[model samples]
Target: MQNSYPNRQWIYVKRPEGRVGPEHYELREEVLVGNLAANEVIVRASIISVDPYIRIQQHERNTYDVPHPLGIVQRAGVVGQVVASASPLFAEGDWVSTYSGWQLYARCHHSELTKLDPSVAPVSTALGVLGMPGRTAWFGLMDAGRPRPGDTLVVSGAAGAVGSLVAQFGKRAGCRVVGIAGGPDKCKFLTDTLKLDEAVDYRAYSTLESLSDAIQAATGGVDVYFDNVGGRVTDAVIPLIKRRARIVICGAISQYDGGLDKPDLGPRFLQHMLFQRATIQGILARDFINRMDEMVATVAPWVRSGELHFHETYVDGFDELPAALNSLFDGRNLGKLLVRV
Candidate 1:
């Protein structure tokens, strides 16, 4: 047993069944026995992020999985408190952000956990609104989606973690944002709460014709489509784009379960891209490395001013990880999902 501390962690156990299951992950408790090297910090996790994209990385994976050898705790960025430090930048009680995965304790090099500005935003926001997801929203819209003022922006996964913030940012930039979500509650939250120009329930309109009609009625033509869950939804949106439209391919959570044999789109879709002079891109948020400090500076004020709003779904127990992760992919989470460690 650890003399003064208990060490515990969750590791990816087996290739998931279809998507993921409790059996896919195994949490083991052990004694804390480690020494921090110079310029390292020991972080006792405060909140753990449970994101939908985590579903895709169980085995040999392309795209987001990125060859992270299996058996490590699933990769997730976390916010935590410094329990011990070996560098001048951090001391006890400091809060920081790092890709610490789903574990109770994380030992990180000093630079791994970026010191959070206490006056700017909540520490939890570092994992959501003021963090990667937020920057994902900010850059994806401006860089790939390219929502010009008065242009119509369509966002899928439109009420979940990244989508909600994207919608708000689109509105602030003077674009009319239309949202497409999986169900009625999400639709309501997006349209009624976030005040999107229109919100379509993907469940209500099963056919492409009806879904297109809903989009057509919303803003006449889509100037930008921010895709989160791919497959049919994207196939449907491809035909409805206006000239010079931009499609931001962020994540395809829908296809993670369906595997690599995802549905192929019509040949005419590629022809449309050429004919309309459109653009499509896959964004990894880390690519905007040069602008992170500036991005945080810009968004932090909005968060502090309450111009930006964030909702987090909290699961109270560390052992409830599987269920919490289930809530993420199933659209049970309204905004960000965090396991309170």
Candidate 2:
């Protein structure tokens, strides 16, 4: 067996001013020796994930967690296969998911890995629908949004990863689901593919008032708002809340560029909360990590029987990691954005 293997990694080198792309990362190659401590395994990355939260962590100041420290492999989730192992729990050719970031190869302790069974679902789904995004969508909507039968649920960033799932789940809960996305193509996906009741294209309207009007027309009045792209879209959704509405703050991809450090405040929709007696909650996937088995058990059956649809936008090659992440902000992806390594 080879004692060492050549590996490629994307290192976060610089903070972004507006948009995060190749300029902020450094791609370097190194050799990894096969020596491992007890309970350690070497895995070769097969798929890597690019998520919006990565940009949030890039902010200089802390938000939900501390800022991502500079000069490290850009943090991400990876689905890979074990090539060598020193742990009883893992073996060569076993598939696993790990927080091994942007590296093509990583030596990880068995504890840091979650063994994946290809027979269950696609291993790449570990980085997507069956993974963090799924957890966020499930808990954020069911627990926080609390959609009921015949309720109007409005989802921003509806064509994207978490938003798409939230829209479908809202439909499953017997709600009237309206999806708000960037362009006509994504809107089409929301209505035609995901089968949402209505799909609004936020980009068509140049002002908040116009966007708000569009959403109001589609939803009539919102009983639940699942927000992923904040800013103007959020401003638009707030006033449309019906009595006892619930708002689940899942993400704010619109402001992730630089607004987290210096926010751009919008309309004071807090008055809407007062009028409607609505509940607003900010949910993170980490909060529901303990209940992962509950989510998988409930949602995995839908995945296996094709009762749920998972759309994946794949960017071929590990080298496309930074670019794929940047494309997220541009609304270039349909569902989960992934890099096939």
Candidate 3:
């Protein structure tokens, strides 16, 4: 082993007014001197996640939480191997997951690391299916969506990570699933691979009225709406809820750029909720962090057995982190988007 390791990091330098891009970040390289305190471990990042929430946090205004403090490493989920450790629980060459952000290497405390067993599933899954995205989809759907047999479940952003899992979970719950995504290829993925009962391509319709009609045509009425994308897509789904419908707001990717700061309050559809006695609730992954085992126990088996489909789009190289995050708004990724370190 070398006495020092080369480390590179993407620092979040500026907040974006509209779309996020490379301009918002600064990449710096340094040599990490091998000096570890007791119970400390140094892990070399192999995979890094670029998610929508990172964009949301960039906004000066608070959404789910306060804005991410600038001039620091872009915070994210990373899967890596321990290169050096003074901790008794971890050793050299052990795979682990940590919230160590967009850095080639991280020095973390023993408790900050989650030891991963690669034999159970691919270590990469710790950032995808069996990780935060999986947890978000599981609890967000089952708890907040409260799907039942024979119910009609409509999922927006259905081709993406959390949305895709919610769609499948709805299917497993015996609900007829209708997925809404942009583009034809993602729509086909929703129907052919995810086996959703119907897949509506929002991009096919230029107007909200047309999109609403398409959604209504596919689903007579929505008993449960698992919404991941807000803006026009959400506007279409809101008015289609059935009696006693449950709406789970997992995300609003369309608004993450600038809409969050100055939201466009579109046409009013709360009357639909009033007529149907529908309930709308917002959920976050952190809310269910305590019950992570419950989510893993149920979802991990299906993942390991190949019963559940977890698609991931990987961008090669650490330099692509900012670009990968920016690409999320363009709807370029079919599922969880990650950067290979």
What are the lDDT scores of the predictions, listed in order? 0.81, 0.93, 0.93
**1 against 3, candidate with superior TM-score:** 3
Question: Could you give candidate 2's per-residue lDDT for residues 1-341 as a string of tens digits?
Answer: 35687999999989897899999999999999989889999999999999999999998877888988889999999999999899999999999999999998999999999999999999988988899999999999999998899999999999999999999999999999999998999999999999999999999999988989999999899999999988999998999899999999999999999888888988787888999999999999999999999999999999999989999999999888898899999987899999998
The whole-model C-alpha lDDT of candidate 2 against the native structure comes to 0.93
Candidate 3: which pairs clash?
Answer: none
Query: lDDT by residue for model 3 over 1-341, one digit each (tens)?
Result: 34588999999999999999999999999998778888988999999999998998999988778989999999999999999998999999999999999999988998999999988888999998898989999999999989999999999999998999999999999999999999999999999999999999999999998999999999998999998989999999888889999999999999888998888889988899899999999999999999988988898899889999999888999999999999999986899998998
Superposed Cα RMSD, model 1: 2.1
Backbone-clash count (model 2): 0
Candidate 1, residue 116: the lDDT equals 82
Question: After superposition, which runs of candidate 3 have C-alpha atoms over 4 Å from their true positions?
Answer: none
Evaluate residue 258 in candidate 3 and report its C-alpha lDDT on the 0 to 100 scale: 91
lDDT of 3: 0.93
Model 2 worst lDDT window (10 residues): 1-10
Q: Against the true structure, what is each candidate's TM-score?
A: 0.94, 0.98, 0.98
